[model samples]
Target: MAQTGIADRAARNGHAADEGGAGLAGRLLGGLARQVQQRIPAADLDERDPDYIRESLPRQWLLASLWFRGEVRGLGNIPESGPVLLVGNHSGGNMTPDTIVFTLAFYTYFGVERPFYQLAHNLVVSFPQLSFLRKFGTVAASPENSAKALQAGAALLVYPGGDRRSLARGLGLDRLFRLKVLPISLALPWGINVGDFLGHIPLPAKITVEALPPIDLREEFGQQPDLDEVYDHVMRLMQDTLDALAAERRLPVLG
Candidate 1:
């Protein structure tokens, strides 16, 4: 009888362990699903409407041109056709006016009919109310989406990853894809538009964006160049341009 009871107890514990494991797995999967839902909504592409962009240009232009007194130079430097990658600095902390100014300049110059897309942070794209962004070809930033846009021969705008990563991609991707990497520089409002993310009154601070000459990576850095060497070259080139822009600024901080 004692032996039989011990065996029964052992079987019951084993059964409970299985149930506990299943329960734990269910919780983990449930948590992961929720995170996925909150972070990466299954909406990478397929919402861009040329008509919507055309209709919206007037409003965006008004804000960019009138309020910010924005100026974008070197739009013509961008190739008139084909897949082009625009990589620029995110100068404004929460209120990235450079993006708006550049977008307006691109659309007005190229016309809304040409396909142009920008990769946005997941936090920005996940909001349901910001669905209008999708209409403007603003998709969640991902390698897959970037590749898809480029492969489709669309003008894709991407912010560099990080210090080292940014340099690596700025050149590496260009060499791999045979792209002309356009580096952008911007000077935007300071005080009034400081809290750009939360919404603040812009001071008409005269935002200026300059698109530097497109760098053909393989042509400039050679077909097989060291990433670190390429990075240093690009950094010096951008920093010099930034310094020049600052020197030309009338309202150094505000603009």
Candidate 2:
């Protein structure tokens, strides 16, 4: 009966299962079954699975507390309820330990039940082991996705550096002013700088992440809205905060 149910699910997902196999071939077929499961769009991910997140929280907490030693500030600026956009710089290349640290901290502080989502690149979403990301409320970065998440009254986290070309075009005025922009930073004391372009292993780094006050487009920019002005204001605020944090760091990775 259980085997029948598995076969039915595979058929519904447009994947055919091989019933006949043994040893290496059976193992290969089992691997394919798992891949098919990952590819199936079981849910639209409009809201996160709080139970799944709760189940996974302990491991994430351990990493955040012991491995990264992450500290988050200005969380009070985040409203207890309502939609808000969190914009931050991207650091530490492909591995992006900073994102992991911030995310775990955010969920811990707010509890897993809160409707929160993080925008990520499609590559990251499609990558292996990251399939669980969707369950934890990560969506591929897109204008439509962003609008949908906000409309649902969920807090959204976005990294401008994650999409450099779009960010550059949108914030061209900042470049013209030669503004110092810092989106995200990771301090590694072990001297293992695992940048995206460099490698994958993350060293034990004391990560500190801060969340700025929420910005309401309708309230701050009015109904009409000034895109250029809004862009400049956000970048400047982030840059100022980055400068302050940098000042406090006496050495690399020690902060």
Candidate 3:
């Protein structure tokens, strides 16, 4: 009888686990569905409709509740369609706050649930618990994954400096690396727009996002592989966007 009771308890726990898994799946699916519902037509995006605000308000509210306030400006510039590249500074600390906060802002302000598929260190995703982070759009930041996302018309966020620069032992503003250039190069030929955000200067940091004019690769690419040339072109565009935003210095800290 004691053995039977133990088995029964184990089975009950399994059922509860299954129920919890199902609930989480439902929530993620719902979030994605909401994104589709809130999508503005490619042409009508110029209107800068407030529908994005409506869809994104909940996320902002949650951020507020967490006492993790930050500003996310420059919403008017996001392209309505096609693949887009987001290159920014990476934080070396565990689970960079910049990545998470910026993602929340994008979802809340833009009404887009497309999570930033970070090109994480392979070791991070290889672990079982951390692998689940992929559902939130974490991916190995490899050339293959980058190309795949662009092909699927997904927006990608990258940190050119990697963790080393953001979490540098000694930092006096080193140059931004070009790791993201690989993804940007792939995105351009696909007519993907590139965006850059600059901000997050420590705890009391603010964010400024800027959208660069889409790299015009249709004229340059004749259905061929000119990766080096493409990389330079995309890098220049990203650099221009970041430089512009950094100059503005409009940091708005939310309470």
What is the Cα-based lDDT of residue 176 in candidate 1?
Answer: 40
- Which residue pairs show collisions in model 2? 89-183, 89-184, 93-196, 94-196, 187-253, 188-253, 189-253
- Name the regions of candidate 2 deviating beyond 4 angstroms: 1-43, 162-165, 168-193, 196-199
Alpha-carbon local distance difference test for all models: 0.65, 0.64, 0.46
* Comparing 1 and 2 on lDDT, the stronger one: 1
Model 2 agreement with the true structure over 1-255: per-residue lDDT tens digits: 655655565567666666565433544555575665455332255547889889998888787788777777777777777666667775545667677777777788899878888777666777877788887898876655665666676777777663524554422323322222222222111112364534456767667777776666556755554666666666677778777766776667655
Which prediction has more favorable TM-score, 1 or 3? 1
The candidate scoring highest on TM-score is: 1
Clashing residue pairs, backbone N/CA/C < 3 A, model 1:
none
Scored against the true structure, residue 222 in model 1 reaches a CA lDDT of 71
The sequence of per-residue lDDT tens digits that candidate 1 reaches over residues 1-255 is 643443344445452222466655544455454456455544445688889889989988897777777888877878778877776665645556767778878889999878888877786776776778788888776655776777677888876646666646532454444433333222222222466555564456777677767766666767765677766776677677777767776765566
Taking all chains together, each candidate's TM-score versus the true structure is 0.73, 0.69, 0.47
Error of 3 at 239 (Å): 4.0
